[model samples]
Target: MSSAHITFDTTGDKIARRVRKMRSSAVRDLFAAATRDDVISLSGGMPAVSLLPVEDVRAATLAAVESPEARAVSLQYGPTNGAPGLRAVLADMMRDLGIRVKPDQILVTTGAQEALSLIAEAFIDPGDIIITEGPTYLGALQAFSAFEPDVRAIPFDDEGMRMDLLEEELKRIGKGNPRLKYCYVIPNFQNPGGVTMVAERRRRLLELAREYDFMVVEDDPYGRLRYDGGHQVPLKAMDENVIYLGTISKMLGPGLRTGWIAAPESVLARINLVKQGADLCGSSFDQIIVEHYFKDIPWQKTLQKFVAVYKERRDTMLAALEEFFPPEATWTHPEGGMFLWITLPDYMDTDSMLAEALEAGVTYVPGNSFFPDGKTGRNSMRVNFSFETPESITEAIRRLAKVIEDRLELYRVFIEAGALPGYDRKEAAMTDEKTPTPWEEVVADSEQNEEAVMQAREGNAEQIDIAEEAVRDAQQAAAPAEEAAE
Candidate 1:
């Protein structure tokens, strides 16, 4: 007798509930678009790896593996926390950032990315409340999301996350909320936003963390790469309650995948337990290479080179934006770090315009993805300056500007035709709301209005003529008002 053929269908039922809720990274999607030869990408917080000290790295690799003793150590399984020597080195590095921690307190992970994941695993449970800056690091959002945390995003300004708003949120969360996990922040040259937390605010943040009995995770991947202005002390420097994360990805090559978490030993112990079940340990070989590089090579010189090259690229992008962007567009002038934020006219949705931007030979990460709730920053984008050369950066900005100009012109037409009621460029620019009308709705309204106008023109010439005359008068009347508002 022939056995009956059997097949099992494992659709959504087999997937974890948390995994089902996770969204794909918008920056990764833009990065894929950028892989095309014709598209220039200002997405992804990628360092200028071309500027890395290749000769030094090569030498370090050789030194790390030449001896039989060294090879054995690298090849063998190591401590879950990290290699002791590298942890010591990382401890010294943290001291330079004003964080005093023993080597035992440092938990070296695969990279800062894994460090973030470990923190989430150690601290967060389902339905826990995790606070972060509005438009915070997308990767951090992805990391915390896996634990099913309720992320509360507080808005930020040029200085950084607004303390007033954060304080109010904490009070609302209440001091007795056991589900409140921690406040995760990229305090130095924060990803996407590129706003540094001021020292006074940093102190206040520590004070609040203590009073509220919540930990503060200070992710400081870009702190040392300052191109201008004095350095602000890290949050960890002032408070032992702060958990500091540092990575060699920006300083050295990201391929090495070396990063460390400097926190209290008790916290490190808990994270190490979670980490063992995740990957057991990071690449033992990579940690050794990082150790040799830090010990033998002039890492500070490499950092200086990165700052010089990246600063030039940043300046080029800024200058190009000034010359090519529409009058209604505004962007941040970041002192350092890979990214700068741009805010377009409110009605313009960067996510909707991304297709047009790629068609125009440029790409950017839509700003909505950076938010915890993905509700705000519809009219914004994050642009990276470190990955592209100055010439390419200029050309990319010029291409992006054309797309913006075309979109803005379309919006103007809709306004002139009275399709968008009570919506003027000036009024839209001044208001800040948590939710705006979705771009699809706006486009649908415009299309319906345009069809109505076309039907009127074809069926009744007299009515069409009157409508055109009235539109002309409206445009003429609004010209002076727009100019006065400007």
Candidate 2:
């Protein structure tokens, strides 16, 4: 009866082969729960949109349709590259990060998300080798998965992606490999990880990219959100050839849906061709709103307010985690960002633990979702501080810690029952340092909690049950007597 019916009748799968292989980030289900008033969700990397001044945004939106001349441009289709004024504003914004770029070199898209997919479409071929941090942005993994690239992820530490390890892999891949397309990085307050790439590491990455003859794609969503750190020069600042992605989603609001790619003119030329097919051009109305927001508004003061609030939230979450989480767990100490990474005992699986967390009135993005493979980092989960109140963050951590403790109890049972075939108690300790085992501490604490709850409730349990039965009997007797009389 329709085109959809005809497609289903003709096509066996109704999906492209490449697209069929792609998988969701396993967050949509959790997001549904996150919206519930009873749940404290640490899953989404949403900014505190309530912190942005409403009057300021209202003024920006009003400016878009203020006059006939404004409506002529804002409401009409424009260049695929971007609005000229917005591009200039973006270039000026880049100047603050020491990235000098011409307006002509920028390509505006729906969001930085669209930029990622376009980059994958422009460069990636089937089975092409691409490099990213081991636990990278989940959205990037989702974007690139459509192309079926053989993703090779390198490990990272506090300083950021280990350049020494990257160099080792670069040598393994050898020089000038055509299949090695690009080295994509989120150098500043990386998603999920919350670790910044130090200046020396940034330089080393650029050097390796040069030697390997591969493009360096920098996805800097949180660069301007710094709270207490010295500046780390952007990769684009060091080398103009680096493809830098910038977004107003963090500073302004994601609802505007504006982001731009500052790349070489040659790169823009290719991507612009692809962009024409992917939406003809971005929403002109949205671009106009953004241009005025940056140009007409004193966005700096608002940005400062965001930093202060975020810093307090981040610290609150950190302090709560310190006080609540088991000693077996570890998490990154981010100077500034919306999210932080928390890893639990290796024997634990966060993906599996999520159900209990939801039941406990909290939710988090399981760490494995960030990996290119769907099944790694099973012991870790990413928590957000930006969306929740300080009190909520603290309570969420406390609930999550209980979930972890429950898992620890199960593991202890397995160990005591000798269900683990080859586990060595000493070698399997959560930490190498000498301390009380998490199993022992968790069991002891659980016992104390159980005792307290039982003492409070069990004392009156028999009497309450007897009284409830007697009331039920009385109701049953009265019902029969009243029915007989009737």
Candidate 3:
């Protein structure tokens, strides 16, 4: 065959439909820009790996490889369900959290990422309804998107997912509807929003699950990382209907890529079958190393240390926000976890302002991506405090504040000049006492300058000219009043 006839565009047509729908992770994309020495990144759900107990990890690795029996298991292929010892260790850990599960109930995967994927694979079907918090974890949204589920996001408050709103939605969907597959939640230190579910809400959620006859995927990667708060029990602890996801990524390091799912054996069996097709099994050596670390090291002490370091960073960021940010800006005060959400004025779009923020030497994941439907959260962004140092975070917040102030001022000018399309004068007057100049008045006063105003609106001429002319006219109009008072 001729070369032209044989040539193929693999990405153009050969790619799977699901793969084509996958969008690049916003946090991952920001990593490249964040690497610059001058840039302070409050992006990415990254833990401070530098603070991890280096000696303990080194010792664990040695024990896993140096011993003959351990070496054989580490190097060889293992069971698809995960190594026995690791499951037992995790079971014991879960017991501490009040979740009673046997080793057989657990299905180990590459990481929490893969566990999410496996769950999505086993349960999600096209057009199935999957409920999540309004500003939920982006990674989970990405995972479920491949399966083409109808993702419905419910708004959350400081206490977490509004059960009242959930009940309303559930009522709409009707009780015991098979089309409703599952509800995914980050109960402890939820991603992006950083709001933990309160005990009352947790109980109500289980009750809803029971009434609605659906599953709850409880993602608890950050549950143990609480810095300052009373410990809230995981939903799985209260009920077995929850499919619990646990990870060593936040606690130890993400490099291990080890995570587990504690679910009913029936569900786990289905997940195991899907996992077999996905990757067969997780890394044998890494699982063994984690098992060793849990057995030999004071893991609880390590968790305490992580809390101390991250709590300082979180506090620093919060204090800096209070000192530097505009009064209109508001943010979540998370008790624990890597992220806190900030909401800017409704007129501000974080997505549009990202380039300016990056130019100002800081980066954040714009909040819109966290919403599955992408219809809201335009005025918000998720700020991560776990990766950067306190000094870096402080400086980053300062830069971000400047960007917000500049953007807000520009937006105000646009609205006042009637340069912005669909500007509502009545709404502006009600919200702020500074009444917006009528477009007709602006036009009537500047009849000779009509060409300039039109040019400014069309981007054919400088906007500064229009703003300056309006300011000058307003000042000139006020001069007589000031003289009369004198």
TM-score of each prediction: 0.88, 0.86, 0.88
Whole-model lDDT values for every prediction: 0.85, 0.85, 0.87
Ordered list by lDDT, greatest first: 3, 2, 1
Candidate 1: C-alpha lDDT: 0.85
| Poorest lDDT segment (10 consecutive residues) of candidate 3 | 439-448
Cα RMSDs of all predictions? Answer: 5.9, 12.5, 5.7
lDDT score of residue 426 within candidate 2: 44
Stretches off by above 4 angstroms in model 2 are 1-12, 416-422, 426-486
Q: Per-residue lDDT for 1-486 in model 3, tens only?
A: 566656657668778898888877888899999999889988888899888778998999998889799889999999999999999999999998889999999999899999999999999999999999999999998899999999999999999999999999999999879899999999988998988999999999999998999999999999888888699988998888689999999988899999999999999999999999999899999999999899889988888889999999999999999999987678899999999999875556688679989999999999898998764787799999999999999999999999998766655565566655555644556654333233332223222243343344456546766776775776688699989999
Q: Model 1 — which ten-residue stretch has the worst lDDT?
A: 434-443
Tens digits of lDDT, candidate 2, 1-486:
565643335674777999778887666667889889999999988899999899999999999999999999999999999999999999998999899999999999999999999999999999998999989999999999999999988888998999989999999999989999999999999888999999999999988888889999999999989988698899999999999999999999998889999999999998999899998999899999999999999999999999999999999999999898877788999977788998775556688668888999999999999898887787688889998899999999999999888666545544443334444444555456434345332333333333333332346565335545654665586698889999
Residue-level lDDT of model 1, residues 1-486, one tens digit each, is 999998887686889999988988998766678899998889877888888767998988987789999999898899999999899888877777778888988999999999999999999999999999998999999999999999999888888989999999999999978998899888888898888888888988888998888999999999988888998988888888689899999998788888999888888889999999999998889999998888788899988999999999999999999899876677888888889999875566788678889899998999899987785787799999999999999999999999988766655555555556444445544556433333333343443554544445256566455655767987798899889999
Clashing pairs in 3: none
Better of 1 and 2 by TM-score: 1
